[model samples]
Target: MQPRKDNAGFSIIELMISLAVLVIIAGMATANWQGTIERHQARQTKQELRTLFQVARHTAINRRQMTTFCPLDAANACTNDWDQPISVFIDPGSLKVLAQPDYLIRTFKAMPNGTLIASHSGPQERRYFQFNPDGTVHGTIGNLTWCPDSLMAERGVHVIVNFGGRIRWGKDRSGDGVVEKASGQPISCA
Candidate 1:
């Protein structure tokens, strides 16, 4: 212990241990960062949905015409699948997709992958939620739930509209500071 040797630098084992510790820390930080990213994406998607619905609702009120909200096909016809691109158009009192080109108001592209847009009438009949000229929802009052492909802890968001055409978000039933389905339950991927 008294003799001075050639102590130039750290030993190979010491260097490897230091590097291994750093890698572990990096891995943990990366995982956390990914979770944060997912949470942000979920929030943004929810906000987009809110804005779209509000626009559709307000359009009908201002124009004093039936406003139809539904997914549109390549031919611009209304499609039942909500996963496709959606658009708001003048209902023309027919409740069908308008034949006139100017009837088309706005179109939203398909949502990002790993996310889902679904609608249900009383939890069974899937239908489009239309707005009346008076701003009240046309006979279709239900929940439009948006969920990620993988239902992680972040869960999902629901834009709930009542018969009066009032739009509100699902409550934080889980009490996790994250809004979930309006049914007081966590959203399911299926």
Candidate 2:
């Protein structure tokens, strides 16, 4: 009888090629997953900031007092560093200082390490902003930009507050991946 051919298994080269394709697919999936995570984090940060501002404004109007929203240092004093944990408090004196813990209405934990929060309030850095008793911003309007320290800078978002204490989101009207400010300027991350 003639020798039978063994065609029951794949060749070594074929197995290797299959594995290579699987590796490539896995790499692509991992990259896409990371980008999705970064985008979600950025959006969550933006929402948190918007909620904080809204709470501050409503609190001021409901209590008929000024409500301040700002990041506090170890000394419980307002600081320009937006990365620190933020607090919303009733500041009758408008001193921008966390006088008593009881006055604090809410506190948001600091953002993730690779995340950044920058406030742009004209030339001078505004450590904090307060809502008047009438639910209007106490001073000049500004915006807070949230960015992730990754190659996907386009996933960043912005929370803008107008003079009337109305909070709105920055958009990418030009279909660009990066968000734009009120003036249609693209947001840049350092």
Candidate 3:
């Protein structure tokens, strides 16, 4: 009788099964990672908008004056230029941020390829808004536009500041965070 020999290695079927399982696990991990990244971006974007709104409110209260956060065409008054960046400061009875020097109130870099469209009524608006000493947002002004550079592996974030000085973020066209709507409108102190 002839002796039979078997290879001391896994069969083709075993190799295929192992590869398939690894691929499945990898896919799941990728999906989870993507979700986490999106949520984080959304939160960050929300925070930035809130910070600006809060700062304006605090300025109005602390200085006992009205404040405005909006965009401009040139830098002047409290700002060195307009539409360049967001600004924050006191202007007579109005604390306005709308020029260079002043517009640099803060800075935030968007995630790669991620787009940020901010508007009081639309998503494609720019960074513009206002606040009163009584903690109310002015006009249909406050809007923020942002976009990521790409390669961030997530969805873009959006923020809006309505006439009530309420900053909100959102995934769709609706606002995010919280906007008091009726109760948030800016008001005079006297």
Candidate 4:
């Protein structure tokens, strides 16, 4: 009888090549996953802000009292730093300060990783949104822009609050990957 040769296992070179390909694929997948996570964080931040605005407006109208949505400082006074923990509270006095803990309707935690900028129609920085009992904004219209730490500023989303207290989201309308404001100008984070 003729002797038979065994070829039951892969060569060392073949195994090494397969491992290299797997490593490359894993690297690509990791990059894609990171991008997806960043997008999700941005989207979540936008939605949370929108919900807070709506809640503040509705609360003001229903309770027949002024409602303020803002980030509070150590003194419980409103601050322009939107990255701080935000609160929706009944401000019957329009003092922009949280007097009693019972007056707080909701408190939103700060963003995990990002920069939040709130600006009025002009060059003024928006410190807070005060909704009148009639559900209209008390001051100038403004927008809240959230920029992810990993992405460009223009890639972030915008939550605009009109004078009527209506909330809307602004996105890239020109397909240029940059969000625009009401004037069709690209949003500048700097």
Of candidate 1, the 10-residue stretch with the lowest lDDT total is 118-127
Q: Candidate 1 local accuracy as lDDT?
A: 0.74
- RMSD in Å for model 2: 2.1
Residues 1-190, candidate 2: write the lDDT tens digits: 9999889998999999999999999999998988888878886787787788889999999999989989998899988998888899999999999899899999988766355455656775678989999999997788888778783558887878888999899988889778888888988776
Q: For candidate 4, write residues 89-189 as lDDT tens digits.
A: 99988999999999999999997678888876366678888999999999778888888886576558887878899988887888887888777777776
**Candidate 3 structure, TM-score to reference:** 0.57
Q: Each candidate's root-mean-square deviation in Å?
A: 3.0, 2.1, 8.4, 2.9
Each model's TM-score? 0.81, 0.89, 0.57, 0.82
After TM-score superposition, the amount by which residue 77's alpha carbon in candidate 1 deviates from its true location, in angstroms, is: 2.6
How much lDDT does each candidate structure score? 0.74, 0.84, 0.52, 0.86
Task: Quote the positional error of residue 58 for candidate 2 in Å.
Answer: 0.8
Evaluate residue 97 in candidate 4 and report its C-alpha lDDT on the 0 to 100 scale: 96
Where model 2 places Cα greater than 4 Å from the true spot, the runs are 7-10, 112-114, 122-124
Cα deviation of 89 in candidate 2 (Å)?
0.6
- Candidate with top TM-score is 2
Error of 4 at 36 (Å): 1.0
Q: Output the worst ten-in-a-row residue range by lDDT, candidate 4.
A: 150-159
Compared with the true structure, what per-residue lDDT tens digits does model 3 show for residues 28-106?
A: 9998887676667656756765776688778767766666554433433333222244455554434443333553444
Candidate 1 residues 1-190, lDDT tens each? 6987889999999999999999999999998886776677778877778878888889999999889877877766666677787788888675566678798888877666445556655555354668888888887577776666556635566777888888788777667766676667766566
